[model samples]
Target: MRLILVNDVSTVRGGATKVALQCLEASKDAGLTCAILVGDDGEGLKPQFAGIRTVALGERPLRDGPTFTDVFAKNYNRRAFEAMEGLLQESEEETVVHVHGWSQILSPSIFYALAKHEVKVIVTAHDFFLNCPNGGLINFHSGDVCHIKPLSAACLATNCDKRNYFHKLWRFRRTLTQWGVGEEFWSRVGIVLVHEEMEAYLRYGPLRHFTTLRTPTAPLTPGPVEVWRNRRIVFLGRMCWEKGVRTLADALNKTGRTATLIGRGPLLVEMQRALPHCFVPGWLSDEEVARLAGEARVFIMPSRMPEPYGLVAAEALMSGIPVIVSSSALIATEVANNGAGLVFDSGDAASLADQLAATDDDDLMRRLSEAAFSLGQRIAPSRAEWARRMVDIYMGRSSFSAL
Candidate 1:
C-alpha cells in the first residue's frame, strides 16, 4: 500500500509540521512507500527528509499575512485541487492520505479533490480547525474558551477572530465550504486527535468518528534531572495573549522568580516590558531549547485557550522537568493526576504565583521530578513503534485506542 503525507509546510515551523516530518521519516524507515505533499516551495527541507519524495506547491502561507487573493483563495484553491486530483490519479489502487495541516495554504479545495478518489483519508486534529471557525475555539477578545456551537447564531454573531469581525466572517465562510463537502466525503474520512481529552470539545461538532494517536517525542534527558540545583522557570511557545504570556509574566513578577521566555510573537514586547529582570531571548534553536529545558527547575504552559495537546509540556515531563500548566490545557489533568506537574487556574496570575512558591520545597521538587520522568517514559514511544501504529491505522486494523 502507498502512503502520502500532506501538510502546509515542508519544514518544522511548529509542532504539527514537526510531527508530520517525523512521521514521514519513520514511515520510510519502516519500509513503507511514502511521499509528502506540502504547500510551500520546500526550501527548508531538513536533513532527515532528504531523499523522500516531496511535492511542493511554491505557494506562500496565508499565516505569513494574507494577500488580496489569499482572502478568497483560502476558502478554495483551484491549484491545490488540481494538484491533489493529479496526484491521486497516478497513485496505486490501495493508497492512504494522511493530512497533518492545511489552513495555512492548501485550503479546503483539496477535500473536494479527495472526494473524487477512492483512497482512504485521515486528518489529524492538531488544532480545532475541523470544528471551530477560528481554529482555536477561543474568543480572542475575551481571552476565554468559546462554548457556542460552530456556525450557529451565537457563533456567527460572536467576534472571536484575533484580528476583527471581518476575519471571523471569512473563517465562517471557509468552515461552511469545508463542511459542505458532502456527507459521503466525510463518512469515509477518519480524524486522529492528538489527545483523547480533546473529544470534550470535538464531540459537540459534526464529526464524532476519531481515534487517539500520540505523537512521538524522544526524551531530552536519559533519566530524572537534578531539580534541586536548577532555579530557572521557563516558558516556551508563541508569545501571544492566548498563550497566557502576560499571565506568566505577571505571576513571575508577583513571585519575584527567575524566569526565561523563549519564543517570538505579538506579545514579546509586552512581556519584555512587564518582566525587565527576566531573560527574554526571542527564539532559540531546537538544541538550545532542549538544553534550557533540561536545566530548568520548572516548565510552564500558561495557555488560556484549550490546547489540544501541549506537546512541549509533555516534552518537559519526559525530560524530568516538572511543569506548571493551565487547567485549560488538555494535558493539565494528566500532569496533575500523575504528580508530574502542578495545575493552575487558567489566566489566573495569582494562582500561578502560588504554584511558583510551592515549587521551593526541595522534597516536593524531587518527588515531582521523579514522577514527571516516569510519566514521560510511560507515554513516549519509540519511533518504530509509533510508525507501526500508523501503519495499523492506515491498513484499517484498529480504532478507538487511547494514549
Candidate 2:
C-alpha cells in the first residue's frame, strides 16, 4: 500500500507535525511506500527518516495576522494547491492520502485537489478547524466554547474569529469554503478521531453517516515512575485562555495550594500578580519538563475548551504523576476510566479547587499514582505496535480495538 501523509509543517514542531511524522515513520516500517508533502517555509521541509520521500511545497504566506493575504491565501494556499494536484495525479496505485492539518499553511484547497484526483482520503481531526470556522470552536470575542451548529445561522451571527469582525468575516468565508470541502470529502473517505469522546455525531448529529475510527495518539513513556519530592501542583503547557489559566489561578488561590506555572503566555504577568508565591519559570526543554513532571505530586491540565486530544495529561500519566484535567478535555475520559486521576468541571474554579484539596489525601494520591503508572503503559505503546495498528486501519482490518 502507498501511504501519502500531508501536513502544514515538514519538521517536528507541534503535536500535529509530530503525529504526522510518527504515522509516516510507522507506515514506512510496515513496508508501505510512505511519502509526505509539506509547506516548506525555508525550514527545509525535511524530516529525519532514511528511505521515506519528502516533497516540499513553496513557502506559505509571510503574513501572520490580519492581511489581504490572509483573506485570500489562508484558506486557499495556491502553491500548495498546484503541488498537490501534481502529486495526487502522479500516482495510480491504491494510494491513501492521510491529511493531518491544512488550515494553518496548506489551506483547504488541497481537499479540492483530492476531490479532483479521486484518491482515497482520510482526514485526522487534530482540531475543530475542519468543522468550526474559528478553528477552536471558540468565540474569540467572549472566550467561550461554541456549541451552536457549525455554519448554522447562530454560527454565522457570532463573531468567533480570534481577531476583529473583519477578520471574522474573512474566516467566515474561508470556513464556508472548508465546509464545502468537508461536504465532499466526508462522502468519499474515512475520519480518524484521536479519542472516542471526539465522535463527530456529538458535534454534528448528521455526521454519524461517516466511517470514523478512534485511535488516540501514541504516548511517550518516561523512565520508570520513581519516588520524588516536589509536592506542589504543576501546569506544564502554555499559559493561555483556552488552557483555563485564569480559572486555575482562582482554584490555586482558593485551595491555598502551592503550584508552578511552567510555560509563558498572555496571562503570565497577571497570574504572577494574583498568586505572588506561584512559581512562573518561563519554559523548559523536554528533558526538564519530564524531570519536573516526574517529581511533581500531581499534574494539571485545566483546559476551558473541549480539547480534542490532551497529550500533556497522557505525558503526566507516563511520569507516574496523577493528572487533574478539566472534564472537557478528551483524555479526562481515559484518565477517569482508568482511575488514574480526577476530573473537574471545565471552567469552574470551585470544582478544580475540590480536586486540588483531594491531592492532599495521602491514601488517594498513592492509589492514583499506582493506577496512573499502569494506565501509562496502556496509553503509550512501542512504536512498532503503533505501526501495526495503523496498518490495520489502513487495510480495513479493525476499528481501533479497545484497550
Candidate 3:
C-alpha cells in the first residue's frame, strides 16, 4: 500500500508538522511506500526524510504579505489541485492520503482534485478548521470560546477574527469554498480526532465519519519527578493571551513563586517587563525542556480558550509532574478526575494561585505525582503502536465505528 502525507510545512517547527513527520517515518518503517506533499518551500527538511519522496510547492503563506492573487488563491489554490491530481494519477496501488494541515497554503482546492480519485482520505482534525472559519473556534475579539454553529448567520455577523471583520469575511469565504467540494468528495473522507473530547465540539460539523486516534507520545522517563523537593513552576507553550500567559504571571506574582516560561511569542516583551523574578527563556529544544521538567514542582496549562488537547500537559504528566490545568482545557476534567492534576477557573488568576499554593503540601504533591505518572501512559499510544493502528485504518481493518 502507498501512503501520502500532506501538511503545510515539511519541517518539525509546529505540533501538526511534527505529527505528520512521525506518521511518515513510521509508515516507512512499516514497509509502506511513503511520500510527502508539503505546501511551503520545505526549508530545513529533516534528515530522516533525506532519501524519501517529497514534493514541495514553492508558495508563500497568505498571511505573509499577501498580494492581489492571494484574494482568490487563498480560497482555491489551482496549482495545488493540479499537482495533487498528478500524484493521484501516478499511483498504481491502493493509496491512502492523510492530510495534517492545509488552511495556510494548500487551500481547499486539493479537495477538488481528490474528488476525482478513488483513494481513501483521512484528515486529522488538529484544529477547528474543518468547521470554524478562524480554525480555533475562538472569539478573538472577546477572547472566549465560540459555540455558534459555523457559517450560520450569527457566525457571519460576529467579528470574531484576530484582525478585523474584513479578515473574518475572507476566512468565511474560504470556508465556503472548502465546503463547496460537495458531499461526494466528503463521503470518502474520515475525520481523525486527536482527543476523544474533541468529538463534543466537532460532532455536529459537516463531516459525519469520525474516529478517535491517539497521537503518539514519547516514552515515559525512567523515574518519577521528585516533586516534593522542587519549587519551580514551568510552562511550555506559546506566550499568548489565549494561552493565559498573563494569567499565569499574575498567579505567580500573587503566590510569590518564580516560574520558567519556556516559549516565545507576541507577549514575550510584556512578560519580560512584568516578571523580573521569573525566567523567560524564549524557546528550548525538546531535550532542554525535558531536562528542565525534572526541577519543576508543578506544570501549568492556563489556557483562556478551550484547548482541544494540551499535549504539553500530557508530556508533563508523563514525567510524573503534577499539572495545574485551567477549566477551559479539554483534558482538565480527566486530569482532575484521575487525581493527576488540579483544575482552576479558566481566566482567574486567584483560582490558579490557589491551585499553585496547594502544591506546598509534600504529601499531596507525592500523591498527585504518582497518579500523573500512572495515568499518562493511557493518554496516547506509543510510536510503533500508532503506526500499526494507522496501517489498520488504511487497510479497512479498523474496528472504530463512526461516532
**What do the candidate models score in CA lDDT, each in turn?**
0.85, 0.73, 0.85
lDDT of 3 by residue, 112-142 (tens): 8888888989999898898789988789877
Please list the residue runs of candidate 1 whose C-alpha ends up more than 4 Å from where it truly belongs after superposition. 400-403
Give model 2's TM-score versus the native structure: 0.87
Task: Please rank every candidate by lDDT, starting with the best.
Answer: 1, 3, 2
| Number of the candidate with higher TM-score, 2 or 3 | 3
Alpha carbon lDDT at 351, candidate 2: 97
User: Which parts of model 2 are misplaced by more than 4 Å?
Assistant: 42-47, 58-66, 141-143, 182-184, 201-229, 254-256, 264-276, 380-382, 399-403
**Candidate 1 TM-score versus the reference:** 0.95
RMSD of each: 2.0, 3.4, 1.7
Pairs in clash, predicted candidate 2 = none
lDDT of 2: 0.73
Error of 2 at 303 (Å): 0.5
Error of 1 at 297 (Å): 1.0
